[model samples]
Target: MEGPAGEKVPSDNQVKTFERTATGLVREISAFRTLVLDLMFTSPVFMFVFAILGIGIFVGADMVVSTLLALLIGFTTAGMYALLSIAYPRSGGDYIFISRILSPPLGFMVNFVFTIVNISVIGTEAVWVSTMALGPMFSGLGAIMNSSSLASYASVFSQPVYIFIIGAVVMLVFTSVMFFGTGPTFKIKSVLFFVAVFSVIVYIAAIGLTSTSAMISNFNHLSSTSYQQYSGIVTSNGLPEKFEVVPTL
Candidate 1:
């Protein structure tokens, strides 16, 4: 019986089916793909490069201690998210949980702000890809090929217009992949993930074989930027010539 607006509301017995039978998306993403997606998001290369960039800012901070603390916190937070996912099987993500626990408006507001923040960070991340990944790749190739022009272009990632174009191209590529739909997107991501993994392996092998002096020499040769200049930056920042614990974070 309905009396509020003289309109009838369906009882549990009367409401047996939904207006729409399908929930729009088919769950084509496998467990492996899900893990791949997460790994791509948490790629250590990006984190390492970002930390390296922030070294001057965190000069006084203990590198080992900071790294350990970050790992501890990150793991704990991930564990909590995992537990929550297991508890709330079908429903997921920050927004879903927040909306359920708190008010939807508050959840929406928080998620919306975070969405904007993530979108804004896209350009920076793209620039990082240009500088950290492509620049390094080009430098390594230059050293191998003995091409000065190739080496010169290694530093091109720093140019404002070049970096902007790199960022824009990266955005466009990803957006185009998204337009192809989720299944194709994950497939493409999987390919990219393996390529990144291989690159990481090569990087680790190269680092293991090469000395610090050699790395510096290569950098100087490629970019025509002196190691002395970088050292000067540290010195001018009031950092000691020899730091007991060099902070990367």
Candidate 2:
């Protein structure tokens, strides 16, 4: 019999060949696709600020060391997830594994907290992406065109009404896609995966090409003497830069 997502059931003798197996999920996703999804989950677009400015700009020459440490932690966490996924082979992730291995009550508590956090982060992240990523990107394009009026026009994305509307639309689109099924969701994610990889490469190349002297000069101007002021600047800029500093591109 065929399961959801077109996963076919193996015969009794066929199943005996493997040490362990699960029949619920479709085996449509390939290893490369899994790698891409894992990459997106771990090193998301939001992490660009940390990888670029946090390590390259602030930490300076120790960027490689910092990156290696982060990779070690990330891989260790990934390994655990892999093991759990193998053992459980279900959709619910931590909820399934915890509920099955530990206790249902404990698993419910854990997933409940996680669900709340995720719901909260959705709106916040949407607003952030609108104000920080899109707004600045358009504003920079306006600058290239030498139009202050265009820059001001683009800044509308930061407004409460605009942010709310755009965020709602994005959320609706995402929700619809997810409701459709795993196959469609996986297809969309695969496209995003390539884009993510390309963006990462570009970010790294940009940093690598920049002279250390220039970065140091920029850092000196951008650095704050106090933590409070520094945090304020970072929050205002959305990706952590001096409050007065403006992007030329």
Candidate 3:
């Protein structure tokens, strides 16, 4: 029946608000699952583990201390994730929790900090990936230009231009996916997950097949004077080998 304002109005008994709400919640959950799957594929776990291994190998005996530090960091990170997840299971992340538990001012500060950290990470990743790409490119260019005395020119190619370009492209693609909404993002996530899993399996297989004798030889070299000499050479090439500070006296 039409109301006085000529608008059709529902009878109290005609509306199923709770059913509609439940349906919407289910859809949201499905979408969230896709988002999480994508994130899992793109996660930094492999890089993190490789970084820890590198530090362990390079720092040698100091790995004991590094391992302890990594453990402490991991524990704290896990605790924070647990606390945030539990506090806002429905809302599902730190932003809402921050706003609710604290004043809006504090919440903004938290978000600001997070933005800075995220951008810093993006910048660092772009540089690192570009550097990795440059290694082979530089080597190839160096060989080609060997007779031309263009090793310096080859060195110029080592700059992270490719890295920044690739990073920008990735950022743009992801941003577009976000704008178009979660459907495509979810698909991308599934592919990423498969790739990540396959890569991990292959890495483990390779490591397992490596010769024990070769591993021992590598370990011995790491412990020898040559390793220290190489470390010093690498460090000094990048930065001053020693710092001189004038005495206050």
Q: Please report the candidate that would top TM-score against the real structure.
A: 1
Residue-level lDDT tens digits of model 3 in 52-145: 5555345333433544666777789778867776655555545666777777678888889989998887676556544544454555555545
Give lDDT tens digits, candidate 2, residues 1-249: 777789887766664321225565545677777777777766567566555565435522344456576777889877888887776554537777787778889999999999999899888777876887789887877756767786886779978899998899888888899888878888898998889788978987988998977766655554434455654766666544432212210
C-alpha positional error of residue 139 in candidate 1 after TM-score superposition, expressed in Å: 3.9
Candidate 1 per-residue C-alpha lDDT over 3-98 given as tens digits, one digit per residue, 9 for 90 to 100: 699976777678442232345653657899999999998886665565565555676665546767789889988998897787666557777767
Residue pairs of candidate 2 with colliding backbone atoms = none
On lDDT, the candidate that comes out on top is 1
Error of 1 at 103 (Å): 2.0
Give Cα-based local distance difference scores for all models. Answer: 0.77, 0.70, 0.59
For all predictions, the C-alpha RMSD in Å is: 6.0, 9.2, 9.5
**Residue 5 CA error for candidate 2 (Å)?**
30
True-structure lDDT of candidate 1: 0.77
Model 2 RMSD, rounded to 1 decimal: 9.2
After aligning candidate 2 to the native by TM-score, how far in Å is the CA of 50 from where it should be?
3.9
Please give the lDDT score at residue 41 for candidate 1.
81
**How well does each candidate superpose onto the true structure, as a TM-score?**
0.75, 0.66, 0.56
Which ten contiguous residues of candidate 2 have the minimum total lDDT?
A: 240-249
- Cα deviation of 201, candidate 1, in Å: 2.6
